[model samples]
Target: MEMPKEFESFAEARKNNFLNVKAAKDAGKKVVGTYCTYTPWEIIDAAGAMPISVCSVSDETVEDAEKHLPKNLCPLIKASYGFAITDKCPFIYFADMIVGETTCDGKKKMYELLGEIKNVHVMQLPHRQNDPVALSLWKGEMIKLKEKLEKDFGVVITEEAIKKSIKVKNEQRNLLKEIYSLSKLDPPPISGYEMHKIFDATNFVVDVEAKNNELREMISGLQEVAATGNSPVSKDSKRILITGCPSGGVAEKVVKTVEEVGGVVVCFENCSGIKEKCVNVDETKDVYDALAEKYLSIPCSVMSPNTGRMELLDELIEEYKVDGVIDITLQACHTYAVESFSVKKVCNENKVGFMNLETNYSSSDVGQVRTRLEAFIEML
Candidate 1:
């Protein structure tokens, strides 16, 4: 099966993300490292800084991270802290400032210790999604972040700058949504692993116009391939919807296992997927208010009574015609682990198969996870 040149381009882009960020730093560009999807990227952009995701997905640094952190904490937190302390990841190393949110206790506490090593700024996130007061509090936090960025970087963030950032960010989101939607075609033109790689690489691409143009070309190329009846997957393959914690860390074991068996992951409801791309910020409203409302609506497990997640899951399952749902929760990530019950209930109501698999960043459980996935895909 012939693939598009853009696919290779995306892979190569990620392969050199570290160097890309390093180049930006060398050019005297301010870099802002972020950990979660909750961070307001527009504000960071408005502050005249490059916002890059600093979350770590590999277990290579976990052992070192556990020295100062708890052994049982989320691998993401430990690996992230480990990278910071060891100066392993160039993104974290080149970051002029780090913006964190109170999305989870593990990350919040880790930020405190991380502050000792880096210039860390924490945002007070309110979990209650529907309350007006909570929105106000979140908006205030956004303003505080703006002021902090201005003070630290010696650049004032103006209303015009944020409005432009919002437009540019939405353009990227729309492009991603279009790319992700291509999976809705029977016998998807691309593999889940390939699709995920593109999403993960978007965070590190420095030139927004060039990145978006590449995505547009990729979309056209994929559609042309699909039109010719060339697909990377079989129509009979089980269409799976992934919903849970940030999956980039565990994708090697889980995503690869699914495709290796007989399932095709059609949708991702996590941070690495449509969770943040499905909605766009309203350009008609106040910049701060629009940003607060748009970001606060993200359906992460951190929000109390996270009804939005279930609703989004239900919608995706139908839209993608998913045959099953896999909820991958990282060990010690209690929020997603507990929320798995509700995710299962939603799948049950939709008459779709559901499985909850919990594991860490280590490859020690590779065989065990493979065995379970084999049985699950066989049952599907």
Candidate 2:
């Protein structure tokens, strides 16, 4: 399928994040690598440090990681560790420090191992997000993190800098949200894969203003396509909502399979999806507290009483007019695997078709996955 010219720059950026990091480093910019979206990029930006997400979804690094990590561990964690140990990832190599979060047990323990090779700072994310004490603890952690960045980078993170970062980041999020809202149109002007590419590309790019402009242009192009009655998906395509683990690499595979089987992925409620960009920081509040509140609200499976995730899923289902839900849990990702049961229950309560797919990073089961998705689409 032909892509809009406006989106070409974003697509190119996704392929060259490493190169961009190299250029930034050569220019003497300190780069901080992060593993989770919960890591406050605003703080990193304010500290004059480039914050780049270092999560790995490639199967190529898993073999090396298994030498240190258990073979049965989550592939995302294994792949991340493997990339660090093998020096296979440019982003990891360029990073002066890696920010780890307690999002899941596998990741929490894996960071310990990652620390041996990299300067790792682990954030103790609260498991119960709504508890007042948990919020206070998280707020404290954010403050500590801010101080650490200032001391480590030798740059004072003033409130003014943080607020500016917040405004820039919020603008990016709003643009992304606008692009995602286009999916609500009948015969969505863009495919889910295209939307995923846009999101993934934005993550790699450091220039928020440029990215925001590119996104606006892309949205305009999409709107023009919609006005002309052009759609990448057929009007009869089954609308699908995907929720579960991050599914970084697996997202493209699942989306491709679904589309090939006559389904259109209209919404994604995972870490790598629209939900991550849907929330904006309250600029009126204390920057640290606002960051704490915004990140805490993320519906990661690690949090107890994950009602926020369910509520978000329910809202997306109704808003997108979803016909089915596909819960994707990476093998050995126990948090999401266990949460799939509740996700399935929610889908049933809504009278929507649901399927739970458990897999790993390897493409060996592509045929099996495709067949399963085909059957699921048939049922829908």
- Go through the candidates in order and give each one's C-alpha lDDT: 0.90, 0.86
Name the 10 consecutive residues with the lowest summed lDDT in model 1. Answer: 1-10
Q: lDDT per residue, candidate 1, 149-221, as tens digits?
A: 9999999899999999999889999999999999999988999989999999888868876899999999999
Candidate 1, superposed: residue stretches over 4 Å from native:
1-15
For 260-341, candidate 2 gives per-residue lDDT tens digits of: 8899988888988877777899999998889989988888888898888988988899999999999999988887888888
Clashes of 2: 0
Candidate 2 worst ten-residue window by lDDT: 1-10
Separately for all candidates shown, the number of backbone clashes (residues 3 or more apart, or on different chains) is: 0, 0
What residue pairs are clashing in model 1? none
Q: Which candidate ranks first by lDDT, i.e. highest? A: 1
